[model samples]
Target chain A: DAGVTQSPTHLIKTRGQQVTLRCSPKSGHDTVSWYQQALGQGPQFIFQYYEEEERQRGNFPDRFSGHQFPNYSSELNVNALLLGDSALYLCASSSTGGGDEKLFFGSGTQLSVL
Target chain B: LAKTTQPISMDSYEGQEVNITCSHNNIATNDYITWYQQFPSQGPRFIIQGYKTKVTNEVASLFIPADRKSSTLSLPRVSLSDTAVYYCLVAPGNRKLIWGLGTSLAVNP
Candidate 1:
């Protein structure tokens, strides 16, 4: 089966610019979550989308938002980007019912905020 | 969310077994211990998970003590390809996983 897939492996954006990163969850999975990893740091939770609605969120700001399409694909949008926004944007997919909620991650999109 | 603490970095020779331990003193009753491995530019991949006692898998082994305050990830016969950052996370059911800095393991030739 295909694993979690993300688009635009690498991206460049200037300050105040907006960017959107896409993700397609693994087949048979329905929940999508986003995370950000800075240099020399572990991935930080951004938010999670289930049933086309944001179910839980982390400490990130409003500029960071996400959407889960009906097809289970997800998009992470960050507005008014700052240089500090530069990091690796990761998408993880998991299912909610039945089995354990083990997450499968994508290769991630590297966001470079200039 | 339970807070996790692990080593900043570790080094092991090829063919040697490596054990990385993580501490989560405030771990709740419902939380589960999960480990993830990450390469230089890739997303974290789930390694193994356990709640209590020991759990072994093809790639690695997880040991959770009865107290559940700490867990260890053991990788046997390490190779250069085994080098990566290992994260210890605590999640309550299907909630957001809390990630710590993680232990950076380097397997040398």
Candidate 2:
């Protein structure tokens, strides 16, 4: 029973550069969501993916996008990154069938934009 | 999405019980209260959740009033390992969760 897993534990990039982070949801889970957390702050929702389509998005700009594969794995892509984009990118997974919707999260990818 | 308000920080000694309350005045009828705890470099972990009344797990207990406007997370017997930021979220089933600053709990020896 593997829990959610994310790749590229840490990344460094410059302004205007792009970065891609990956996530594999927990077993038996279908929905995947991404969040961004700055130092000493709660996570901010980036978007959610279900059935290979983005279902919900937060206040993030268009520079942030994501993809969900058939296997329920996900990828978060940020283009034209700014210095402010430096933060911890978290991946959370949940099962849509269950009414409770308790999420399981991965350790997250730390992105540093210079 | 209803906004949640919790204490910015709390301090307590080990072997004492700690209770952190969260207020969500605009909570909807279908909304449920969920709590999470996070360490310095790790993702948030689910502690407990409840719709109304009380829900208790091995880690903590969640108490939701009948009005559903506020809830309290009770952690029994504090320990230094329990020091972390606790988040309270309110959302309907299957809806995106909205997060606030969360309450930072510091357990002292």
Candidate 3:
């Protein structure tokens, strides 16, 4: 079975520019979540998607948005990116079973904002 | 969401057991303790999880006391590859989880 997959392992962007990252859920998984990890820090939750609708969001700005396709794939869009936006964007997937299910994470896309 | 606290860093030699403890003083009754391991520039991987008592897996073991306010992740027979950051998370029904600076374990030869 395939694990979670993410596109654009690394990216470079300037301030005020927009970047889009993609994620494919693991086999037999339906839920997708996004996280951001800065240098020397743990990951912070961005949001979660289920049933093609956003279920819960973290304390992120409106510039950060996402979409979940019919096949359970996800896209994370960051607009007006700032220098601080440069970090590792991680995509995690889990099933729709009990809430305690473990999450499988992708290697993540390294975003660099200039 | 319950908050978790772990050590900043630890050093252990190979062939010895390493235990990383996490404290969640305000853990809810329904909250469960989970652990994740992450190497440099890589995504975190699930190590083990438990609600109470002891749960052992192939890679690690999770020990949660009856109070449920704290837990420990024990790695037996550590090696250089076992050097990574370990996170402890407490989630009730797996809602919005808050991750803190995890404990960084460095296994030496």
Off by over 4 Å in 1: none
Minimum summed lDDT over a 10-residue window in model 3 chain B is located at B90-99
Query: Could you give candidate 2's per-residue lDDT for residues B1-109 as a string of tens digits?
Result: 8889999999999999999999999998878889999999999999998999999989998998889999999999999999999999988854567788899999999
**Tens-place lDDT digits, model 1, residues A1-114:** 899999999999999999999999999999999999999988889999999999999999999999999999999999999999999999999998742578899999999988
Clashing pairs in 1: none
lDDT of 1: 0.92
Q: Between prediction 2 and prediction 3, which has the larger DockQ?
A: 3
lDDT of 3 by residue, A10-81 (tens): 999999999999999999999999999999999999999999999999999999999999999999999999
Better of 1 and 2 by DockQ: 2
lDDT: worst 10-residue window of model 3 chain A: A95-104
Q: Rank the candidate models, highest TM-score first.
A: 3, 2, 1
Interface RMSD, Å, model 3: 1.2
Task: For candidate 2, write residues A1-24 as lDDT tens digits.
Answer: 989999999999999999999999
How displaced is residue B25 in candidate 3, in Å? 1.0
